[model samples]
Target: MAKVGRIKLGSQGLEVSAQGLGCRDLSGPGKPEPDMIALVRHAIDIGVTFLDTSDFYGHNANEVFLGKALKEDEVREKVELASKFGVSFADGGNKVDIRGDPEYVRAACEASLKRLDVDCIDVYYQHRVDTRVPIEVTIGELKKLVEEGKIKYIGLSEASPSTIRRAHAIHPITAVQVEWSLWSRDVEEEIVPTCRELGIGIVAYCPLGRGFFSSGAKVAERFSENDPRKRLPRFQPENLEQNNTIFERVSEMAKRKGCTSSQLALAWLHHQGSDVCPIPGTTKIENLNQNIGALSVKLSPQELLGLESFVAADSVKGDRSAIGLATWKESDTPQLSSWVAA
Candidate 1:
């Protein structure tokens, strides 16, 4: 197997693996701790040192699990750890709340530090833009965290171009995580350009179209009763049936390229630019290895365009997520003065 390569995440000098491990699924109930630790260790062993997690995932259980995974000597130092704040659960994990007030920012960082058992987080992100709080105010608190050595870099997820600019003006945003896949090309128009202009890295989450390219239409059939994708519009029987046509087109191209549909999908993102890194999450070791193999599936400029043609943004049916309000298009905060007045 080939080793995972490295990349400079942003102008801020934060370097990490070309491919990152999304550690969200490694936590939560019924997931064996020992196996999860082994999965993380395996990724580290193979040079995939960038790990992503969120405080909202499993309601903080993910960070605690990561702390244990990196507890051994030298393990933490070898990893470029990125965890997020801002989103919290209420009403028995049924109600989702986004928060970016200064107090919540500080408290969330302190809590994440404790759970991760780390003195400094490599990269900390405002998982969602809390429209109630001004972007400047939220970023101001994050700037203080950077100065205090609590977090080395800052990131934003699902942030609009204006929000990104405002946040960057307050502090350099090291990265912006968004849904960018073969079927999710909406970010290419404005968000991608803005990040490039501001020297921010793009962390492409769900780069495999949330496993659609990997398993095709059958993916919907495999979803468990409690699977969140069940609620997503794209995965609904009618929409999924329509979306399967797009997958079929990509799968046919992947076979000609001598790679799986998943590899081809990820390879397209890899060809996007050196500044873009895809963090596709998987619980199985085989899937982890497969994701890493994407680094080797090179695509020429023509092949890149060919793949894009197969799954154009309009070609895919349904919204990216069930909650449309959480995407970058809707991720703008109120003015700082308005927030202050309130």
Candidate 2:
């Protein structure tokens, strides 16, 4: 078993495993609940101590399941737990609603605490920016929570540079979670630099390009009707054919490096900087072990460039999401005075 190493996230005193385990899609339809619980325990047993989850996943079932998983055998005490709020589903899961009002923030945190059955969350994040509310108001309430010992640290996800600045001004943002992978490099332009400038950590979700870098194009063929990837533009048949070429080139490079494509993709993020942590989620123990192997697969500066050339950010086909889901580029919020006047 490979023992995962620990690193500091942000300038805060918080420290976690070099690579965290994203806790999503583990409690949804067609998923084995018992197996998922076992996977969480197995990950903690192996030193993958940073666990990430969201309230919107499975319509709140993910957090409830995590509560059950952590209660068994004193599992909760062994890891740094993180979860998100501010995003919810409406219209039978067809419409996405984002809320960041002070009232919503406090109520959401209390709900999450009950679901996780924990007294204090290690890190709490606003999952999506609510454009209607001022970032200051949201952070102000979060600051109150910190002082009250409800959450130890604050974080933001899919926030614009301006929104991040405003929120961080009110309270220290320990981390910013975003879609950062070989195929998703847009964050590097602004979000990454802003986080670095503020001494914040970057928690990279979908670090393997939603499993494309790991399983290649064949992974798309396995998507069931319920799978949300089927609706993503990148997975459409037309775009997928073009994107497969990038995967082929990356596959060749991975072979040359004597590592799997997934390991190579993760290793590239590991080389970005010490402040970046990639949380690649997996339901299978075998894949979990394989992802951990990425830690040992070192990459030289020249090799890193070679991998980037194979999948340059712009060369990849299609948007990160279908559209209108409150991504960072569209994450600016209303001004505090404007909201007050309204």
Candidate 3:
């Protein structure tokens, strides 16, 4: 078991492991389910007190899988559960349907609670900004649930800075979920800074760029015909070829530092600030343990700066996302704000 790294979540009373586990991809389409139970349990045994899941991941498959894993003997109390709402599965496939109405908010939370088989959620986040419904009204209903003892904290995911500020004003946002990494530093300027000023924690998803940082996982495999990574611009031929150079350097640094590329990447993200926690998601036990190993690899500011410069110097290869998906929920800057949802 890895030793836990503790940090305060926003202004809330809960303290969690600095490196949490993201459970979305475990049971989602194109992932292996046989590995999820042991993988999640392995995370819990290794000081991963924070576990994040969402209802939209495969039409509630992620939540139901988590429920079964949580029922393991004496494992339920070991983790702090974070679930999300505001995005529903309109069809059985991959499409987000926004529903932030107060009634819908309550209903979504209830469904997530039932799926997770938990009495109260440690953290409940809106999966995305429902531009139709005012964020304040969403918070109003979430706060009502807080008063009702159904929720512990409110969060927003992939929202703009203005939305974050507005939502926080309505209620103290304990944490904001966003895809922030060395590769995805889009949250540095206002979103992350604002969270710091306001004392909210940043839960960095995709800390590994969806397996881009793993030890033996090469960029070439992602370009395979059936792989979804091919659909992402960053994984295109030219972009992938150039980006692999960055990975090469990352691998070199990892060898020099006596760790793997994934560990170095996760360590750097965790060491960025005490308020930031990176929940690098993985479905393989080896990858899960490798990620947790990051808690012990403390990087100095100088090393972090060096890595930043190296990444910047290396051509980013391609845009992180495609046209609409690249937008990441309507932001207009290289750096944008983030909010929470589940």
Candidate 2 ranges beyond 4 A from true positions: 91-94
lDDT of 1 by residue, 15-110 (tens): 999999999999877789999899999999999999999898888989999999999978999999999999988798888899998988999999
C-alpha TM-scores of all predictions: 0.97, 0.97, 0.90
Candidate 3 backbone clash number: 11
lDDT of candidate 2 over 173-210, digit per residue (tens): 99999999999999999999999999999999999999
Which tens-of-lDDT digit does each residue in 1-342 have in candidate 3?
647767887777778887898887788666656667878877787788799999987688889999988986967788889999977766655566777778899999999899989888989998887776677778889999999999998888887887888788888999998887777787887788888888888899989876787732365564557666667777777677777777888888888899999899898898888888888887787877778788788777788887887578346767666666523347322211343333
lDDT of each: 0.91, 0.92, 0.80
Runs of candidate 1 exceeding 4 Å displacement: 91-94
- Compared to the true structure, candidate 2 yields what TM-score? 0.97
TM-score of 3: 0.90
Query: Model 3, poorest ten-residue lDDT window?
Result: 331-340
Point out the worst 10-residue segment of candidate 2 by lDDT.
Answer: 333-342
